[model samples]
Target: MTEFTEPEAKLEALLGIINSSARQAIAEYKKTGHGVPSADATTFHPLDLATDTLALKKATRLLEGAYHQLSAILAPPQHTVMNFVFNYNWACTNVALRAHIADVLEQHPEGLSVDRIADAVGLDESKTARILRALSLMGCFKEVKRDVFANTRLSLILKSANNTGCYAHYHSRDVSKYAGVLYETMIDEEFSRSHEVDKAPRVFACRKEGMEESFWEMMKNDDERRDIFHRGLIGHSEMMGTSSVLHQYNWGDVSSVVDVGSGIGAFSMPLAKMFPHLRITNHDLPEVMVQARNAWEENVPEALLDGRVEFVPINFFEDIPVAGKDVYYLRHIIHNWPDAEATTILHNIRKAMGPNSVVLIPSSSTHSKNLAVAPEPMLPNFGAGSHRVYQIDLTMWFLLNSKERTLDEFKTIAAAAGLALTQVYDLVETMVIEFRIAQN
Candidate 1:
């Protein structure tokens, strides 16, 4: 057996990953000419604001993967297993987001006393202190002085304005409820065998609230929830560093692109900003189209002034996209549906493709490429470092009866839609898979 496959080499392998990955991250920071970020940094590093984070994420993947593996390997099994159950990190983060603790703390650049902070947000002093202390342990907040909390770089992400905060709010509030019922959904007669969106744990949990409609249907009907949800998608992209695709993909060669199921032009706006020559189309339901236009006007107004962008409302399962575009880009779309619906969306796009048109599914491309191959002696996909991805895979199951797919799983669906997978670009956060119309 290879050393990587041997049980004895695990610890040694982890240490190597930790050392090398940490060095890689240090190099990324130094290359930025900003040195490395301090643990107590109060604001974002310049790299944090950069659209390209391929190097940073690459280093992080290894660093995160190794440390988590080492922890799991060395820590007592009881500590690790109970961790799956006794975790209150989410609950504490929920409190921080809901209370707008980050916003309040932002006013006190130096720091704020727990009692005063609690009074400012109108929560009990001791309870606020407890939650802050808990999250502080995880680096979300800093205890500048005993019972005095300050915003850290991580805490800034929890601010009311940040998209990651919105993402967290939705997940912590709604997704958590659905997750609570995951076991019940697994064993229940009606939901157990169904892969339909309506049968999701989310719908089951909210059965009494009359959440009988599919996730998309419900989103379509509710304006407020839909707005928050779409904004969260933008936040989702930022947190995932998906904007790197603009630099990674060969957009310069493509004349035009369509963002299918586009939510407020999250991907397309940045694409348009970065590549001014490429014509862009944003497609979604009618309401979301209105949103996309407004967002484009606000964020990519230059594109609007030049009349280079178009908003086309689409129901992807039934409607073919605007035809003959160089690319039909679906960012974070297919993963929200089960095989049947996902295939239908692809089929619809397939119908729109001219001979040269390519359909791009950017979210799941890494599995088919080198990006997902962990360093030897580590679990492929980078065990603990990839913890979030696995958690998100479960999140899809809980919320929509959908999932993240392995390459083969994604290809099976693509084949069913009469498309052929043509290329794969492994962006650090997600993979961008390219497909073309199948040759019969």
Candidate 2:
């Protein structure tokens, strides 16, 4: 063993003393629920591990407090590293990886060596190894050995040609088109300001010359892309849909239900299936309604499609044609606009709602303080304390100038629209804010 110098030996001795003191404190706390003074009280007053257990407890609490404080200081760097790892390559790298994995696995269902996969996908062997390593860390693939890789459950999903998996439009160039704009928005203030109105000018401008499309608009244009977008929304809905007031809602009293801005009828179709007696009308833009109608006809039962569910094409901002529905369900819609615009949308629905009708707005809650009930501590402590929701809030800010709101904010918006907040249901991260027309 290498011998230590005098300074090093002295430092080691100090650390040993500290460790002994801590251990003694812990033992005292364990034994008597308090800490006792050690025999060497003059030079090294080790904690009393016998009777003074509270001292040990206090030290443990202090250590926890210091750890959290240090974590708070280091959080920015940690977040930066994570963002660099995930957000780097503008999602193109992942798309390319998915495509290459799928192409290779299609030929060799048994499994292909790393070199063979690289050759099949037209990638350099070393570069492929690096990419595969990254993907393996992300749980997208399994590493059989040092450089060899095999398809995982996630990889298989990407390899499938059918619409079943989340990979249908994973490689869409259109999806990656907004990456540059998003990147610029992160670094440059001027570009960030411009992105507030025109999210993807290159793509959105080409599609419709001068018109600006919200982030969702570009994603919902085509079948494959719409499927991918809806899959993501379904994931989000599943997470937030738990708070849905539909269970507490009296579906028996309602004859018809209108789901406004119902994209591909994820919310409406399920309601129709749940309540066979209630007729559900899915109202959306003409393009979306076309897809919704096709999806409903193909996926829903023939009997339900015949009369129970109808796809109506209407610009909700202009006018709502169908009226007297007992329940008007709006999920993940109101949070997409500022208060004034959200109120306008709500007012239009109110115009179509009867006196006794209940309008349900299922939105993610922005209440950060209430997150004390969360089992684990939420990250960033940004307004709502949820990193996912906060990221979405920023995405909304840059894309549509909309915002996710707190419960009080929702209530205020309802009041502005001459609606009363009847009940608020908390569903995990999502909230169902039920409203009725206020009596004069």
Candidate 3:
């Protein structure tokens, strides 16, 4: 019965949303019997490591969106604008990831002095302390005592072996560089009006530095960078909680699945494990296929032995995937290219589809009003709650001249590929959009 038309009423509504969503998140944590995580906690909570975090994520989306909206409204205009312009947390996080600060702190549960920490990581003492202190403000690392620091739950994510850490590393170091030239690329004649992959801000930035290999070509040539990129992808899955689709979707109905553009089988490997009955095929370029084979051999050799999984090397732009699978799942693939290339990829997959086959694209559908929207008094796209969705869209724009699409945009591309949007599974940060052949 409450109308949220006025600014005061809306603020009250957001506060209520914040309170309710926080309680929901706490309840999810308590459901695990491990209680909620403390701000200063050094270790991960049990739920933190669990595979299905959809409930927690849902609550968190609202909680994040509401509080951030409340803050923007209450804070001074200059302060809010400056916060956007002056944020350099990415640079600080990059330093932490590259320097292995969390790995160093892991050995010191009681915390370590800045001097010892710097010496261990070979960073200058005073400057390193500044970085740690900056990150500590956001609860990443904790200043346990004067001039000493210890890892908190957030900081533990930056440890070298963590998948999500790998993702953060790549984003912070590489993507940030591309992002820096956004304005220049927008105004440049050759790049400004083109949607070609080579016209991306990344190409512009790289050209400035006299490095000229395309992103994929560069990845193909560098073994270490390629390895890190693939691992970072798994971390990307973890960060976006894309793998939660395993539990949310009805895999029981899917007997076989072709993982289109599958990098190292991040989604398929777990899918195969969870539903042993699924005949999973990974489709990627030859080099990625080799890596995917090794990953499968090392991680889930049993699935291979049982004849449940296969690796099919493909240049998805040109190659049609294996014919007639129940599901052709493209996770985080389409967003890497512009509309024309994306349409071609989907159309190629369309060629391999059987009458009943469905192409599942789990992607960041940026600001799709058809999907989740905030109630009145809050930004419709949930503002900061949907922060990653918008950022990833920009990331695509920067790196490849591509972008995350709206639901209508998705349908347009799907229609061009002779497919129609059939279903959408809203999985918090991203959604799994199901497409099938268009009817006459």
Top-down lDDT ranking: 3, 1, 2
Per-residue CA lDDT of model 3 for 222-329, tens digit only, reads 987888889998888787888889899999998999999899988998898899999989999899999999989998999999999988888888888999999999
Task: Report lDDT (Cα) of residue 421, candidate 2.
Answer: 81
Instruction: Give per-model TM-scores.
Output: 0.96, 0.67, 0.97
Model 2, residue 37: distance off in Å is: 49
**Which of the two candidates, 1 or 2, achieves a greater TM-score against the reference?**
1
Write the residue-wise lDDT of candidate 1 on 1-440 in tens digits.
45656666878878988998999999999998999999999999999888899888888988988898888888999998998898888889989998999999999989999999999999999999999999999898999989999999999988988887888888998899998888888899999999988888999998968667777787889887787788888788777778888888878799999999889987888888989999998988998899789888889999999999999887888888998889998887899998988999998888888999999887733344445678877777777767667787888889888888877887899999999988877887688788998898
Positional deviation of 249 in candidate 1, in angstroms?
0.9
- Candidate 2 residue-wise lDDT, 1-440, digit = tens: 33446654634443453455467546654455334433212111232111112334333433333344334444697774675566534243455445557557656544568898888777788887777777667655657677777765545445434332342344334434443355554555544444344433343324445545556566655566676665545445443333244465667787888889888877776666667888888888787888777777777766254687887888877886489888888877887766776888888998898888888887655554443232112122322224455555654554454567877888798888889888875544455778899877
Ranking, TM-score, top scorer first: 3, 1, 2
* Residue pairs in candidate 3 whose N, alpha carbon or C atoms collide under 3 angstroms: none
Index of the highest-lDDT prediction:
3
C-alpha lDDT of residue 347 in model 1: 87
Q: What is every candidate's alpha-carbon RMSD to the true fold?
A: 1.8, 14.2, 1.4
How does each model score on lDDT? 0.86, 0.60, 0.90
